[model samples]
Target: MDFDPPSNFSPELMMRDAAAYRPLFYDPNTTFYNGHDDQHPRRFNEEVTNDWYDFLDGKLTREQIAAFMLEGKKVAAIANSSSPKVKAFERFVRLAHQVDNYACTPINPWSYYNNPQSDTPQKTSEELVEEAIRDYRAETNAFLKNRYAFQALKALFYAGNRDAFERFFGEVEPNMPRNTLYYRALGYRAGFYIEVKDFCNANLLYAEVFNHVPAMRPVAATSLTLQDEKQWEQCLRAASPEQKTALWALLAFRTGDNDRAIRSIYQIRPKDPLLSLLVIRFINENEGRRWSLIGPPTKDADPKANHMKEIPRETFDLIRRIASEEKTENPFLWYAAAGYITSWSGDYDGANSLYDKAAGQMKAGNKEAADQLRLLRLVNALSRITEVKGDNVERLTEELRWLYKQNSYPGYGEGGMRYKTAIEQSATYLSTLYAKAGRPELAEMLDHSSEKIAQPGVVDKLIAVLENPRTPMEKLIVDMYPYTAEEFYFYKALQALHADQLIEAEALMKKAGKQGMTELYTNPFNDYILDPLDAHTRKHIKEAKVKYTPITLIQKMREGEAKIARGEEVYNNSLLVGNAFYNMSFYGTSDIWRVPLLNASIFELVPCYAQEMVMTSPAAKKYYRMALKAATTDEQRAKAVFLSIKCDRNDCYLGPIRGRALCDDQRYMNQSNSPNWLDRDGFGELMRYANTQYYRDVIRECGYFQLYVAKHKR
Candidate 1:
């Protein structure tokens, strides 16, 4: 008899194997391009490869990718399914994390609306009904012989045509052979019965299907859940041999019969994807004690934490064995889930081995999805380091950095957003670790990297860094994000503010704000209008309409390329130049861009450079200032005062990159080391502002302010 390796088995080989799959020099910005690769070759053809690269690089829009995939799916049905084109099509969809074949029902004819108009031809009620019936017939005709005929029948039921649906459903039942069509049709009819609340017929049909088709037992179980407890119990009692054991396992778990549930789960063989998932769910629920991490608690007052407790070694092995036996399109997820359980159970080495296996399997199939696998592996590795695991910290951090590089590389496809949540979580954990271990620089670096999916925890970290008196003003003022020129300028302003160079700060702030607003603040009049306009309005339409303008250096470069491509000379133009006379104000700067009060407030909370913006029109600031002065209500006055102070504080403290740095120059993650007079938290300063009773009276909604007030009460 063979026994499993002990929990403390060496994971060095597994770690090394996992690291080998990661691409060298992975950077999201520079990996993929529009043309075919000569140096770094791919297995796919030119068009397919280009499309993949374009999709990954953010060049291909979501709509374009969707349309391409849809067309490919349609063509694959009629064309030689085994052709390279079809394979490419299938691979493309998989790369984008979409299914090649989708189960989509036709739209109901009743969903269409006929607009009433004097000039439009109108049909009689009988003709209208006849038209709807004809359309429905055509729709059913198209899908009847198709694999999704059952879905078409279900569509009829959804449109409230119960009589027609029943008639057609019955007609299709007897002729339906024991194939995918037969299974699907039976499932749909059973679902229809459930929808009509005919529990007896639904249960009878469910029992028949569950008994005959082992594959659809999972679908049947989902439907069974909607029934009353008595009805479900009756169905379970009448379940066929194939489904009886699964249903028993489910019922046992539901009723807290742990031993029976575990036994039933173990007895289950491979190839039962749904049952396997159910077993996994049972294990997770028991292991979590409450599946709060999976989602919010069902009860309002329920605790929101994962209370992890190690199960018996036998139980753990059983679950792992079940996951290993799974033979599905994506068993890697099950493997990863098992790994998560092991890690949570304090078996770190066991978890690493499991992760390594999952990553290996996923990489063998689809290289694109392997990024997600790597992300999971790295996250688990980070989770294992509780009290700074010596060399493991640097190793894990390097792996995380590699993961970031892969996610950022344009060659990876449009997965940055998809993988962002995991990446951010890992970054947050690593940052927190670094901060606690007396590595503020690394902590701050990781903290900045985690901003894409940054939470309130990120704000807390920023507050901590700023509050640390030992942290140099230069370090704190470092450009946390320098991806964009606008951000760079804004960051520099913060640095200037820290250095007490108010003039430079004000100028930089203005420049940064202008850059941010120029791109984001588009003209409202660009979209189509609803109706005819008055003569006066029509006369002003030409002046009101404005074209899109490029503001930042990147935008300017793109626009210039398009213009040059159109045979237009764009360089050496005096019209594009700005002549600034800056030594004028009390801050020693000329007229400059300043962030709007609303944007300033938002940036203070979120702290991303892209969130920084100036007033689009100079008059808007004057108008807003006038509005502030005209305010009479306490709430209005309080908000205005806070906004003013926030803007002033930001102008004085926030700065951009000044010297060489370890990180990239992207505005999104830039951070400076400089310190400023105002705290990054700004709570104390705000509390001071709200010192007056009237200010305090209207600040009830602001929780931050409330907390500050509570901490420093008179």
Candidate 2:
């Protein structure tokens, strides 16, 4: 009955404005650290387009440039103007293309390991490398020179001329402006350091790139590698305060030890925006680990201290201290995060107080933040409700409606708010409360499942409400009920049929409408008792000539019962009724009848149904006994005895209590409680007709009977 929330935190709501960093947080599309591929490329394209616009002095429109760069349109075709700026832009674009041809091709790190014969990269020619170097030497304009230097560095690095790459980097890096292009060149040098196995220098360079280049931060962080503590310390020692913060950010991402990273970055720069991302990630991870409000209480003596053990003491203190200081860029973020942690730890009062403060600090018209605060407030309200009765339900109706609305239409709220966790958690909380309030029908409706609905009386209560919902709570339950009235009627019919209430079952089946016409692939009154485990029996049942819908089958059984009542062909009528009951069971071909009724698999019906109704086949056994009493010949009597014994054998194997002692295959037939029905009087009567074709058929087909006779003879 435990219901764990899908997730308790909405990273999209928290970081909607921080689009560059959004991919770094929890995304349903990708695992942690495995970010969205488009984030970096999108940022890179935006920055590059801006730089290109400025470089061309707006000679070509931004739209034209975007189409040229992103849509693979030729630059010459987009910029047909003969101005010097456009001409210079053309040269720059050509050099950029040459550099990108080598740089942008994806390098599969596991190519050699995964496929030894994987194709190698197409090499950049020496002539192209030399031409890039010449372009850098000739360019005098600072912007054009930086662009040329980047191309030259990329070309040399990709050309496998490590000596030339280092020589050119040493000459050009000092004069290069610390912009995205400069960071791009620096990233190449860092890759070289990693190639040379000097992880310390490589990590240091990557940290610098991470700190300076916002568009390339993901790439830099992914590339930064500290093989051991020695290299980590070496990088930290050589890094500036900003670079050190970037290194800590990478550490937080690589290892989920965000508390240390947040503190380390906060110590270096209290106002660092990275602190917000790290703190939000930390809070979200904790939220996922926190216990549900209705889950098992913690070991703490106080009933209110349910999830106190889930929150890390140190991290909680750190978040509280930071929120109190209000130093981070998003003070509202810190306060809201702190409030959520407090709420999860069972301090509803303290949590609401912080939430109020967070609301006060939140920027007006910030819908995402406003929605987050409202959700938290709702959670606090829901957590405080110890009982679900008239007063509490009335008081929280609006909030509950809002929560349900958000879940029903995800785009209705501040879009992409992670409400799945809250929705599932609230359902569990409300369902548990309703159960305690002696309203289990409402509980089952809120947390509807085949297993819960299959519990006795749940369906009857559902049927009552569906028939006439007088109360507001009943109407609400009806609104939230997942299945239609027809399905409920069909389910009721199934239960009735299980209990041998044929008249009620027929009435309910009539109310089931078109659902009652769902066809069974095989005959329900087929005299051959099917073993579900037997391949041949399954094939034979699949190829059965007779097909009957639920209504038709029930009507047929009713007709047979009427014939039995009139004592006309009483033995045949009894046998037909018995076969119908038997085939409707878990072991029989017509178990497919329950598939649509329960919305469960044919395989799952046995476990999903009440064990006694299915496992014992009591109705079928009763009818078989009636058949034995009316039988006029040894063949008829023998058939009745054998079919009844099949029911007893099934009961031994499947009955919840009797099944336990008889389950061991090695001790199956020898068990003290095992039903050796073949040794009983009916079986003795069947044996008296040993020469009959019916008895011969039973002996040939029934393996258990053969084993029993063999044991008795021994």
Candidate 3:
């Protein structure tokens, strides 16, 4: 995919003038391009005329150019060579990008060979099988020790020569060595068996490979082996110490035993790619978004219970400790993991350096490794750059966009397919960043570029709402991917309000209010009702208030209780006690001056309490006296008054009245189920007044408020 220059962005200047644009090189020192230090900058050699920038600018004609990510904070000798090996290394790097970015199988004619189609010619299955068998027989006799036996076998299997395959397999099955042909054939057969649901055969093939070459078990164990616990236990018993520990950690994680998973993962000494990936995902599940093949779980029902912004210090230290050790063949995994850990820990500089190291290692090694690492760095960088301050983040984001643009892997080849996906996701994320940075045009373009990219139906549309606001908001709710039905309704109501459809907005807001507990923090009536209402619209809003708001019901219930109660003073005293308890619990002292520190003041509090008690208490007492005027017995009057006080107390605790709105607000239960301001204060006010028999009875008896409590209790 290509980037079209937005009105604000200049492609020509970005290409020609280095000063006009921030360079994408991995810098090692603090050099401020726009008043913030560019992390891990790569220097352009004075002698080397064909730098990466020159290549991108089309000034350099060379097919390959040497690019360096400075090693640590020091300069390294540039390996300037154009040998075949160097060219191969360059292709490998591009291949890595292709594979990592476009992570899906390529659709090609070869894979479509089974289909009968003809501009030229098509062979029948029987004829293909006959040819394969003839080739196998001739080759076996002519070259008894042929290295291409697996290829012949694969062809025969593909052509439906099952009998021939069986015979050939019997001949080579017992003695096949642990090499490319053997493992490749084993993998193919295992996959075939799995496709056929022949678990028994698949298990045997996987076991043979695992037992013979444990280091290569990742290919086999990547599938769901844990479904059959007995077999998994056998595989576990046969694994090396490092592999065993990693497996244990993964198993523990899958089963929701985080403490054990952490303990087992810490036991792993050597670097393992699978383990690194698992650990990064595990950490992500805790800190950021949960990664799942099925996409993220519904926002409210998020699988991760321990949602936090930062991981434990020990977790970060362990990852860094491993990253700092001797570099392994798969050092990119450690580097990427360490980068993610630090990034999550708010150490963007450290993360940038670690990613630079990983990129450098990838440059030195194979493209396959580099590809995955590149995307890993991109994801971490995009997420972390948002948290970073200054103009540097913008510069970095632009550089990342350039990187994505320059690394386009074309064609429908396997590498290209995966690279396409990589670019799409990367571009989508970039669009979000652009949107946040007030570059909506660029964001829209990037989002459009990724329209062909397959994503979860819900999340994709949620993202679409941000990218394409011109599209009707109603069209974006293809099932409300990240939010609950009620949340969607609430969001939709807000959208309607923005569109000036006040009646529709009010109706939708009422609909949302009817679902679960209506949030108090952001009152739809006040906060979302942006414009002044006309008489007709005001009527709709009034109807909405009567339909959705719980204040009326609570007041009526209070009035009924007041008409039967004996002593209104007793309830007032109880309320005062509850207020005092809340004040002491929240402020940590009874000093009136300290109350202002609670983001409120005593000046407002005294009158608020006085007005609340004096005005209401008298009316309630009058109602109680009127209801009990005919009571000939003291017992009846006492019982009537007792019930009245309970009703008033219940209102104080759980009613959606003016003062206790925050206690039942649904915003606290937003996507991550993270705590809000009320949670921070220990929900002291609600806790002090709620949980009494009165409050419990009101919630249990009042059908309207039962679901509200269930949905928003936490």
Best by TM-score: 2
Pairs of residues clashing in candidate 2: none
lDDT of each: 0.43, 0.74, 0.41
TM-score of 1: 0.41
Expressed as tens digits, the lDDT of each residue in 27-118 for candidate 1 is 22232111222331222234344544453454444444444554443442423455443454344354222211122332345544653332
Across 1-714, the per-residue lDDT of candidate 2 in tens digits comes to 023234455666676356666556643234433334456445578777888899888778888888876666776645667887777877777777877687667668788898866747766888899899999999988888888888888898888777899989999979988888888878888888888898888888888887777667778767878578887888889888988888898898877779899989999998887888888777665554454643323476655554534666888899999998988878888888898878767788898999999998899998878887888888888887778756776576677777777753242122377676677778878888888998777888888654566556777787777778876656766777776677778867876887888999999999997878878877778777447656776765654477788898888988999999999898899988998888876677676445444433443243344444555577888889999899998888888988887787776555334332222334434446433455655455567778789887877877766766676667
Off by over 4 Å in 1: 1-174, 178-201, 204-234, 241-269, 279-318, 324-333, 356-365, 368-373, 387-390, 406-418, 449-714
- Candidate 2 RMSD computed on C-alpha atoms after optimal superposition onto the true structure: 6.8
- The TM-score, computed over Cα atoms with residue i paired to residue i, of candidate 3 is 0.29
Candidate 3 regions exceeding 4 Å error are 1-205, 210-231, 238-321, 344-346, 356-394, 397-401, 407-714
Q: How do the predictions measure up, each by TM-score? A: 0.41, 0.73, 0.29
Candidate 2, residue 456: lDDT: 66
Best by lDDT: 2
lDDT of 1 at 205: 67
lDDT of 3 by residue, 5-116 (tens): 1111111111222222222111112121112322212222221224333423443233333332211121122135444434333433343233222222233566456653
Ranking by TM-score: 2, 1, 3
